[model samples]
Target chain A: MSIVGEIIISALLLVGAGFMLVGSLGLARLADPLQRLHGPTKATTVGIGAILMASMLYQFVGHDKISFHEFLIALFLFITAPISAHLLAKAYLHMNRTDRE
Target chain B: MISIALAVSAAAISFSVVLNLWRLLVGPTPTDRLLALDTMVINSIALIILFGMSYATFIYFEAALLFAMVAFVATISFCKYLLRGNVIE
Candidate 1:
């Protein structure tokens, strides 16, 4: 891979890893279940998305081949994450509904 | 440079997975556990991608894609069960 490609891949990997770390930290340390919901849904999804982007670039720049398979993973995750998060949140709220009564 | 980055990022992501495990084991609520499991799935996906990049292979791409699909369905079904007291009903 060229120097520029290497640098870009490195930056993306580091950034993605950092985001994953922070998301996990939030998941572990947040006080409320609802509060903790933010971490994995947003930050972690973005983190993996970034990593997949890096993978796509790696295939292109390093191997000199076009690869779009990573995009399918990213797209599936992006579409499903919010739906699952929403369902989880709804379930949590319903489970706790008696408290508000 | 790419190898160094891959190593560091892999280490960091692995640590994050450990954190997710801790939350999964110790979470006070089922929702918290679910959240942790979901995060762990995402982290694992990232790890697989990193491994593929490290090895310079294309085969792992399908593995990652299939894992993502399976994980998503699993999460959704779990959520549905939680919401409705049953997955199918």
Candidate 2:
């Protein structure tokens, strides 16, 4: 791979990893589940999205064939994350709807 | 350099998974546990794809895709149970 492509891939991997780290930190340290939910939903999506882009780009630069499957995973995650997050929130409220916070 | 980067990212992601597991184990509420489980699924998916990238294989790609689908279904069913007290009613 060329130096520029290498740089981009490395950057994506590092940044994605960093986001994942931060998101997990939030999950562990935060006091509330609702607040903690923010971390995994947004950061994981963007983080993994970046990693997927890096993978697709790496394959494009390093291999002869084009691959769209990486994007397929990203798209699936993007669509699912919000739906799961929303439903999780609803379930949480269904149990604790009387509490004021 | 690529290998080094892959190793570092893999380590970081694994640490993140460990943390997610911590939340899963010690979450005060069932909802919190489910949230952690959902997040863990995404983390594993990312790690699996990262593995695919480093190993230069296409088969892990299929596993990653299928895993996502199954995890999504599992999350929905678990949430349904939480909301309705039954999954298939």
Candidate 3:
């Protein structure tokens, strides 16, 4: 890979990894489950998205092949993450309501 | 340069996975545990992609995609079960 491509990939990887770490840290330390939900649903998803973007760029420049498979995975993840988070939140609220009543 | 970045990122992700495990173990409620499990699935996907990059192979792409699909279904179904007391109606 060229120097420019390498630089971009390095940055993406580092940033993604940093976000992932922060998200997990929040998940482990947060006192409220609702607060914890924001960490993984938002931060972790963005972290993985950045990593996937780096992978796609790596394939294009390093391997000299254009791969859409990474894009497919990213698209699927972006589409499903919100739906899953919503469902999980709703389930949490329902359980809380039932427990209190 | 790229190799060093990859190694560092891999280490960070591994640590995050450990943190997710910690949450899973001590989470106060079932919802908390489920959230941790879901986050762990995402981290697993990140690890798989990093493995593919390290190996310079496309085979793992398919595995990652399948994992994402399965993880989504698992999360959704688990949520449904929690909400309704049954996975499927």
The TM-score leader among the candidates is: 3
lDDT ranking from best candidate downward? 3, 1, 2
Measured with C-alpha atoms, the lDDT of residue B54 in candidate 2 is 88
Which regions in candidate 3 have their CA more than 4 angstroms from the true location? none
The docking category that best describes candidate 3 is: high
Candidate number with greatest lDDT: 3
Which portions of model 2 miss their true places by more than 4 Å? A98-101
Cα displacement (Å) at residue B39, model 1: 0.7
Worst 10 residues of 2 chain B by lDDT: B34-43
* Model 2 docking grade: high
Clashing pairs in 3: none
Model 1, span B1-89: residue lDDT tens: 99999999999999999999999999787888888888898899899999988887779878888888888888889888888889986
- What shift in Å separates residue A69 of candidate 3 from its native position after superposition? 1.0
* DockQ agreement of candidate 1 with the native complex: 0.90
List the global CA lDDT of all models: 0.89, 0.88, 0.90
RMSD of 2: 1.7
Report model 2's TM-score to 2 decimal places.
0.96
Clashing pairs in 1: none
